[model samples]
Target: MTTFADLNLHERLTRALGELEITTPTPVQASAIPEALAGHDLRVVARTGSGKTAAFMLPMLHQLLQHSRPRTDTRALILLPTRELAQQTLKQVEALGRYTFIKAELVTGGEDFKVQAAKMRKNPEILIGTPGRLIEHLEAGNLRLQDLEMLVLDESDRMLDMGFSDDVLRLAAECRAERQTLLFSATSGGNAMEKMVASTLREPKSLMLDSVRDLNESVVQQVITADDVKHKERLVQWLLANETYDKAVVFTNTREQADRMGGVLVASNLKVFVLHGEKDQKDRKLAMDRLKAGAVKVLVATDVAARGIHVDGLDLVINFDMPRSGDEYVHRIGRTGRVGGAGTAISLIAAHEWNLMAGIQRYLRQNFEYRLIEALKGNFLGPKNLKSNGKAAGSKKKKMKKKEDAKKGKKPARKKPVAKKNSRTNKPAVPDTNSGFATVKKRKNPGSID
Candidate 1:
């Protein structure tokens, strides 16, 4: 029953939230906003679609509004992993801070560098961007963060996974030494995350809103066994044809696969858009715009879209290829079932991908609902044998033989060494001190001459 007003947010921010119909603060927003308003560093671990963007943005905006500064240098910097996410955050900032006079600018790749530099000259009070392009701006002497009052690293884990650790760290180092830092991620990013937290935050308040295992409870996770790529393609086509969803996303492991799948879906007469790292920026924006406008019903993409794209009514996520890690799986399914909405996630598991799928399930500590499409069923049902941990059982013959030998108190038999042969003479070779080989020396010559 906690409202945005109860969190002591600025009147302008509360009014903006009211206009947006976001009256109640989500769990993350409720827990983080107060502490953030109190001027404490924060390291937040919340599920995706948990309103984390607003959680940090509201507090930063509230503070910025309460304290006015004459200088035009950027007071806040929000770094995201992808351009899409950066753009999304910019929209959120604009929506939430509409009533206030504070201005914000977005700096990311795939745009004119000179234009962005020109924008920097105007000195927007807030800056949002990806780390790579932002670092470039800093090096080119167009961007400065030494006077930044707040730094927010949204999707910090994904940034690390994309190998932005060095860039992020360098950016953090460039910021004001006493700036308040806020880090947000959906999954606990393990040791690397810990290291980054240590390096960036100071006496931070840790808010673990939910664990990875408990993410996306409203999403029904299921798997359909497939024989191969062709089988998966058929299954994907059938799902799109029959599934009840306003918008759906199909995730593949590689850009090549995303392109190929996009083609297949389009050929099946389904409205589809392909999004991957290789797509041009304009194409990416067009795909997203089309999806939001309902011009495209399906988006075939790589992990690039996992955390970047957000669409309402996106209630179905089809994993054409199983994600390589548990964190990636969480982000992919998170594309749907947002903000307590209901969604479905179906993964196509081929023979080669069964173990990887099983590993993800085990990592999440949850069993997926097994589903079968009777009309399009393929040869693969599942692994015949499974271990207690849900992994495919390995052959146990060798272990059984060892046990039998132990019971009989017998030492294992050793194979006799085979003699080395001289390749040229086709005769057994003898070992000597040098080079571990000595040929029969002149025996035929001795028999012929002496």
Candidate 2:
């Protein structure tokens, strides 16, 4: 029978929360908010979408309201791992503090620095930003954190996971030593993250949640043996075509891949949205927003898209390629099965990725339940025939390697890199693209007969 009011939050803030229909605090919010409000340097480990944002934000808001009015100089600082996350946190802060008079500014890349500098003239009571952009302002003397008393590192492990330790340290150096430091992350086991926290937080209290959010147990993790890149594409196509999935988000490792996948998905006559780093802010927003609005169901994205993406009713997450870390695996699949929802995560595992998948399994403490999607299986696409431009797998273009190596005295590499087979090895021999993708069709001879 406990609620936000029982947590000793200010009536005004509680009223604001009530208006948003947030009467009951989540486990994270209930535990983290009161501790944070006491200005204890605390570390919180909780899953995404656990109302952890408000756990820190409410206290930050109340402290800002109680201490001073919105000014032209910055006072409180929040560092988020990704720009999308920073924006999402800002949205929550803005919504909750609508009644309270507080000016908050967000600083991140892919935006006009001049415009942000202009806003800095108004001196915000709180500034939320990604580490890189925040560091830029701090270096340029545009971001003054001398007056900052409260600092929240939302998704701390992710900040380190994204290689932001230096930026975080630089930003911390700008703030007062006595300032409050609150760290929140889904994964708190990283030593580097801990070192960063050691220097920033003051006698921090650690609150860890019991469970990590994961896709439903019913929706098993399956890995398909993709011998080559093209086979993976075919597999994706077959899976998408056959599966009666309601909505799916496919994650690739890079921006180019996302764009390429977007085209392929669109050609398959599926509504697709691609989110990546190269996309302009507007385009990226439009992609995710449209996906959320149900205008697009298949979302093709990079790791940039995976972090902090909250889409309701997402049915499937395809790891067209997996990220190189266990933490990444957690965040990527955490996109699905959110808020007690059931969803599936499928990874298209190639030979080159076996080591990575092993590490991910070790991190999650569970091997991916191997399942051969029988209906969606396909052979690999390789440089099988004649072509000048076969791209190289190890060195240069696989097609070029296949072609040039054939014509001259140069010896060719082994057809398939050998690996020891483990359990679930009974599937048909997967195909590998030997030469290149350009010539999938049978080639007519350029007849200088051998």
Candidate 3:
């Protein structure tokens, strides 16, 4: 319920936020900005849409404005894990800090390094970049951090999950060790991620806001079984068949899957876009621009590309594939059902994937309330040609029916039970990796992601 004005943000930054009609600070911003303003190193755990960016951004911008450092040298650095998110964060900094001389240069992958270098020569007060390119610039002597005072890792967990931990570690080492490092991630649990945070950050002032990591009760979860990609594609087409949402994102595990699903959705006559690492940064930005303009209604992306994609009022998120782990699932579905709007997360599971799906369900400790969606089911590979006599088919069908009846005989067949989740790290489904099944679950938060 606190307003941005109550946070004691600078008048200029507050005006800029006001121009965007952002009046109140999200929990992350409200809780974190003051601590950051006081110059404490931080390891913050908050959800994707919790406005943590502003938590750090407002304070970092204040530092630039307060210090009024020369434009020929950088004063602060923000190392993000992805180009899109770095770009997104950089834009916010630039927009909010426009009234001041605090320039923010986007140092990321896929763009011309020469252009980034030229911007660097201008020595902006803040540098926002993905680890690799920033490191590239650093190695080429295009960047220096001798006077750097602030460093932020937005989505730090993903930096580790995607194998960028070494890059980030290296960059952090290069910066002044005395500088404040603000680490923001969705998970700071007992997992490997939490360890990374502990190992990197100092006795930082940490605010453990797990609201976003919980099952945003606002984002409904409806699980479905799809035999294959075709049916899942059908499910998406059917879901969008009516086009109720202004925008939605379908998540796949691989870039190929994202590209294929995007094409299929477009062919099904939906306005769509695909975003992933394989595409150049320009393409990714184009896709995002289109989505923001509502030129594209469906965005298909992999987990890497989807992180930190901030779109307001995104009504739905589809897991074209269930995440390999619960933390990933929590972050992926978080794209929607944000900021108090109603949202839905639909995960399509294959029968063989039941092992994984079951692990996920057991993690949530809730058998998903599955709707058969029979009308939308695809003829998965046109149904495998039967290689049996009619009598054989009849016998198998009869036998299966009897087994189902027997299963039903155990008790009145009941609906999947829903558990109140505390957090992703609270409970886990026993995993068998040799069988390729392991899952962790978080209790459903009736409110939001932590």
lDDT of 3: 0.78
Order of models, best lDDT first:
1, 2, 3
Q: Estimate each model's TM-score.
A: 0.88, 0.78, 0.80
Which consecutive 10 residues in model 1 have the weakest lDDT in total?
441-450
* Candidate 1, lDDT over the whole model: 0.92
lDDT of 1 by residue, 1-450 (tens): 378778767889888988999888889988998899899999999999998998999999999999999585899999999999998889889999999999999999999999999999888999999999999999999988878999999999999999999999999999999899999999889999999999999999999998877777889999999999998998999999999999999999999999999899889998899999999889999999999999989999999999998899999999999999888999999999999999999999998888899899888889999999999988889988989877778767977998999999989989999967767668565457667565556645445554
Q: Cα deviation in Å at residue 79, candidate 3?
A: 1.0
As a TM-score, model 1 comes out at 0.88
Q: Model 2 TM-score? A: 0.78
Q: Cα RMSDs of all predictions? A: 9.7, 16.0, 21.4
Best by TM-score: 1
Alpha-carbon deviation at 237 in model 1, angstroms: 0.7
Clashes per model (N, Cα, C within 3 A): 0, 21, 13
Q: What RMSD does model 3 have? A: 21.4
Worst 10 residues of 3 by lDDT: 385-394
Itemize residue pairs with steric clashes in candidate 1: none
Give lDDT per model, in order.
Answer: 0.92, 0.78, 0.78
